[model samples]
Target: MATLILVRHGRSTANTSGVLAGRTPGVLLDERGAAQAAELPARLAGLPIAAAVSSPLERCRETLRPLLDARPGLALHTDERISECDYGDWSGRKLAELTEDPLMEVVQQHPSAAAFPGGESMPAMQRRAVEAVREWNARVEAEHGPDAVFVMCSHGDIIKSVVADALGMHLDLFQRISVEPCSLTAIRYTRLRPFLMRLGETGDFGSLAPRPAKESGADDGRAVVGGGAGAP
Candidate 1:
């Protein structure tokens, strides 16, 4: 088995704008996100990342650019399954606006049953994402050896779903997990079960501080359709 490192793409324009970028076109990383991506190589200095995979979106590609430059020989492959959920008609809408949509409640409390108006269901998204990771895990292990580690740059929702599958948590509870922009989540897979070695290592301890009740519960149990803007 191989270790899988999941890297959510750096914050994007849509993130800062409070919109669900989904698979929307032209949503590239914002200035802060570009800086975050630039710092990735130094952050992952010692890992022997065997293979690199990314969502086809521009932001994911941009996030991996610096890392790829540092390891010029590492091949970069794009996997649509790891792309942001096909938000379809909801793609470019503001999150605040969507909060009023009736579907928002289902997405927050019962994601396994939520389906986007014109896009894919939450369950469908999880299935494809989990399958992609499982397939890639075997491929990397077979080709590179048991100790090999591979990285995949994907989206917030996609990463959460993969993490849930790895943790054996039900999809309905996946919203409880959060991975900030450019955060690294590592999972080691074995014959029997997978172990989550690291979860959302952004190297920032600010999140550990207690949050004010108002700010914390306002969005409690809600899955930020697209990962919300990370730290101020």
Candidate 2:
């Protein structure tokens, strides 16, 4: 029952503008973002966090800082392997505003074969992130029992990809789960199989309170998040 607590970073400046922000540096959380970070620590009040691993990005580090402040014993480590997929030239571009291109259409239809014009492919991102998570779990299981809890803080897209991999999801329908600024997702591991106990939800963080989601076009966490967007 080792608990793996996955977190998406707080609201970033890029998030406010809907930019790609792939592997970009210096994207700190907005004023609201800092507030969100301060609120999440209460969510893990008494749990033994064991280790606080981040995606080696500034925003991810910012997200984990509060948790570390509350729980002094929790070790903080960085792993580039868990960072967000490189959006390449798409970095900083609004997905909604991107020109309609044939390759974009191809990837929308054939995910494994599609690649962002200047970024990593979905399959590639998935492959490495999955491995990083697997290794993180192994270390925790080795030291703490399999029932121990391990915390990971990362980007929305990366967290979404990792969640999908653990639950067997696909490319599209990613919005099914809104990895809100400073949100948490829980997954349990038995032997080698991963079982999701929770998706993106504001459960309990130390001092952080999740921001309210938009009214319309919000994700339902019913599809594309795990077990594929359309899986039953």
Candidate 3:
């Protein structure tokens, strides 16, 4: 099996606008997002990336652009399975307004039962994304080698779901995991089990230092419908 470098696409216009942007066609990276994309080359400088895959969405593609430019020889492929969760009628709607929807609570705490009125279920989303990774892992190993490392640029929820699968967590619990825009998560797969090498690495160790705890909040457990705007 190969090492997987899971990347959440850089922050996008929708991200900052508080829209869900689920499978939205025209959502592109914002200014800070472009800067984050530009940093990809240096972020994984030493790894011999074997292959690259991205969600068939503009934001994900734009996020991988700088890295692909730096590695001209690495071919980039698009997989729809790893695209953002189909938010159905919720697509393009503001997250704040969605908070009032009854289904939002199910999405926050028991995502396994949450399904968009016109979209896919959370479990289905996880299954497809995990399947794509499995197929890619075998393909990379056959074409490159077991020790090969590959990168896949995808949406925040998709990346979080993949990480949850890698850690043997249920889809309902996936929302507890978060990956900031342009964050990198690494996983190593073997015949026995997958190892999570890193989770949400933004190259900011200062963020790891102890911080004062705030008062318990009402929305503390709510997962941002779309990954919320990254650290500001």
Among all windows of ten consecutive residues in candidate 2, which has the lowest summed lDDT?
Answer: 223-232
For 1-232, candidate 2 gives per-residue lDDT tens digits of 5788888887777776656577888878777777778988887777777788898889879888988888877789999888977867767676445534565555445556767776788788878887988898988889887668888987766777778777777755444545666778988877767898887776544223333433111233222211110100
lDDT of 1: 0.90
- Model 3 stretches astray by more than 4 angstroms: 205-219
Highest TM-score scorer? 1
Q: In candidate 3, which residue pairs get closer than 3 Å at backbone N, Cα or C atoms, i.e. clash?
A: none
Candidate 1 on 1-232: residue-level lDDT in tens? 7999999998899888888989888999999899999999999889898999999999999999999999999989999999999988898998889989999999889999999988999999999999999999999999999999999999999999999998999999998898889999999999999999999899997755677744432446566777776775
Which candidate number maximizes lDDT?
1
lDDT of 3 by residue, 1-232 (tens): 7999999999899988888999878999999999999999999999999999999999999999999999999889999999999999999998878989999999989999999999999899989999999999999999999999999999888889899999999888888887889999999999999999999999865434544432111245577877776665
Please report, in order, the local distance difference test score of every candidate based on alpha carbons.
0.90, 0.70, 0.89
lDDT of 1 at 136: 97
